[model samples]
Target: MRTAATLGPRRRPVALMSFVAAATAMVFGVAGCGSSDPAPGADLSPAATTAAEVVTVRDPWVKAADKGMTAAFGTLVNSSRADVTVVSASTSVSPMELHEMTMKDGKMVMQPKAGGIVIKANSEHVLQPGGDHLMLMNVASPVKAGDELTFTLTFADGKSVQFSAIAKPFTGAGESYDPGHPSMSPGMSMSPST
Candidate 1:
């Protein structure tokens, strides 16, 4: 029965203050419910969702070279629930391509990988000498030993991941131009000597 309108003059301020406080508490409580905190079972870790977050390069290293062409090796690890395909690669040092070694005419030849390299979910794709690797063509500067080169790998989904790899002296896998594949320019190396 003690309505605000019927409150005494001395008690009217107290009643108004209580009403204002309750309104403020309700407003803040509603806002708190809609905060940015993730819901239960939601993944918020660094390894959670997104191609850039779930994909990582392990033990990345590039072949040291004074100029021309070289290759980079690493283990592409995918931690997501879906597969990620690397369509292309690039760096300030040179233009890069995803390459793979295959047996051609009884020779192990390296060529531009068709459809790119796919890193399966919860698995790893190794890029090693005489195997799948990232070829850096027409390097402008020398990639000296202990030099760190940054690279960007663009995925099929338009998502990209950036990583850095150290350069190391590697004389193995002497690659030569494939004469059978005349389409490849003379400047390109297409065959890996087995």
Candidate 2:
């Protein structure tokens, strides 16, 4: 047998080059088998992959107010496989707070939500007049009917979603904001008017 050591220097180089080319071709052929397409049962939906994209607000509306404080109501829908929490909200119109209504001293009272508003996976959280809502405090300008306000809701994962809500006149909730009252405990009161 003619070994590489006995072969001419030029033939030795050509044989080495052929071996290298064959190895490269084999490696690339194996690598090309991995298709760019997602595997079967893989989730390709935007909501399933993103945090803020998974949550959406439906029928969003703000309670019209001349000044002071007001609230926004809507249905928060989460379409992801995991739950999402609305940790905070922001807008140029006013400072926003996540609030909830609860019974205190035999009366319904509105208070700042301690943790946040949690929207369960594939479910909805209703922000109604007498339920969990977004409170706009010390509005810089009057919110009139038909006026649209943009708000950014920050999630627990530091992701945020921007949404627009139309202001609508509503006066039947019996909700009142008193920043000075000690009984309110850092929020407004939602006691029904007697």
> Which model scores highest in lDDT?
1
Question: What TM-score, to 2 decimals, does candidate 1 have?
Answer: 0.71
- What is the number of backbone collisions in each predicted candidate, taken in the order shown? 0, 0
TM-score, one value per model: 0.71, 0.71
Q: What is the lDDT of residue 96 in candidate 2?
A: 80
User: How does each model score on lDDT?
Assistant: 0.83, 0.81
Give the range where candidate 2 is weakest over 10 consecutive residues by summed lDDT: 185-194
Stretches > 4 Å off in candidate 2: 1-48, 176-194
| Runs with alpha carbons beyond 4 Å of true place in candidate 1 | 1-48, 180-183, 187-194
- Candidate number of the best TM-score: 1
